[model samples]
Target: MRTLVVVRHSKAEQSGTPDFERHLAERGHGDAADAGRWLATQGIGPDAALVSSSVRTVETWTDIAEAAGWDLEADFDRGLYSAGPETALDLVRLTPPETTTLVVVGHNPTMASLAQMLDDGEGDPEVAGRMNEDGFPTSAVAVFAFDGEWADLDMGTATLVAFHVGRG
Candidate 1:
């Protein structure tokens, strides 16, 4: 089976910084690190990660990487900067076949939309209900499982196996 993890960038403070340069807030760092630790406990580790090049996204990944002790390098893509759900799915579909676990770190509502759209509503009713109500909050991780290669991933093909939202 293949696993896909989609993570929305952690909380970012809006100041004089531009959208692309905005760094993660203190809460974001804590939340992201907690998420990493949680993933580690669940024995979930990504073989590869596709991350947005934006500052907040990069910072969030760095925190997660440190806490998870993952040495893999991330493929930071410019196309993921502000892309929508379709673009996010396309990027996931293009992942190499050898990577059994792939993680994507980017912004929302694209991340949330992709999670909600790809979910067949057959995994966890509680998670799905919470997602429907609150949407994908920052630092939320949505995990999907499938029985095929990355190239064949289709809408609603993967089953949502787990979902988590980290908080400071």
Candidate 2:
């Protein structure tokens, strides 16, 4: 089985700075760390990560990796910065086949849409309901379980095993 974790970048400053360069806000750091800690508790250690090239997203992954005590490195993809659900999925599909656990950190509604689109409606009904109702927020993480290789993953091919909104 393969595990996929989708994450929306943490809160970022709303300054005049370019969107790509916008840094994470104070709360974002703590919240991302909390997310990492939570993933650790769940024993979700990712072997690969694909993150947006945006500054905020990179910082978000950095904090998450540090807090989770993971020495993993992430692939910073510029395409992910503005990728929609399908595009994001294409990026994830590029993941190496040997990677059993992978994480993708990007912006929403891509992250949120990707999570919802991938759900096969065969896992936790309550969690899926909550995710649909609450919407994906900053520091949100969606965990999925797939029975095939990364390249073969497609819409409705995975089960939404868990949903979490990290807050600190």
Candidate 3:
């Protein structure tokens, strides 16, 4: 089975900086680190990662990887910065078939929509409910299990296995 971990970037500064250049806030760092630790405890070691090129998303991924003790490199894509759910899925579909576990760190609305769109309602119902009710806040993560090749993945084809909201 293949695993997909979708993450929304942690809280970011709301200063006058450009959106793409905005950095993470103090809370964002701690929350992202906690998220990494949580993923580690869940035994999720991603073989590949796709992160948005925005500063906040890159920082979030860096913090997560550091806390998880992972040494994998991530593909930072500019397209991911403003990609919608379908566009993000297209990017995911491009992943190499050999990768069994993939992590995607990106902006919200898109990330949240992707998680909801991918759910097949065949896994943990309570987790799915919570994910729907709580909305995709900062540092939110949704894990899905897919039994097909990455290229063949489509809407509602994966099962939501877990959901988490990272806090420090």
Q: TM-score of each candidate? A: 0.96, 0.98, 0.99
Flag the better candidate by TM-score, 1 or 2: 2
lDDT tens per residue, model 1, 1-168: 999988999999878988999999999999999888877877888999999999999999999888988888999998899899998899998999999999899999899988988887778888777767778899998888888989888788888888888775
lDDT by residue for model 2 over 55-140, one digit each (tens)? 99999999999999999979999999999999999999999999999999999989999998999999989989988987999999
lDDT of 2: 0.95
Which candidate number maximizes TM-score?
Answer: 3
Steric clash count of candidate 1: 0
TM-score preference between candidates 1 and 3, better one: 3
* Local accuracy by lDDT, each model: 0.89, 0.95, 0.97
TM-score of model number 3: 0.99
How big is the positional error of residue 21 in model 1, measured in Å on the Cα after superposition? 0.5
- Candidate 3 per-residue lDDT, tens place, 4-97, comes to 9999999999999999999999999999999999999999999999999999999999999999999999999999999999999999999999
The window of 10 residues in a row where model 3 has the poorest summed lDDT is 116-125
Model 3 residue 135 CA deviation (Å) reads 0.4
Question: What's the distance in Å from true for residue 137, model 3?
Answer: 0.3
Candidate 3, superposed: residue stretches over 4 Å from native: none
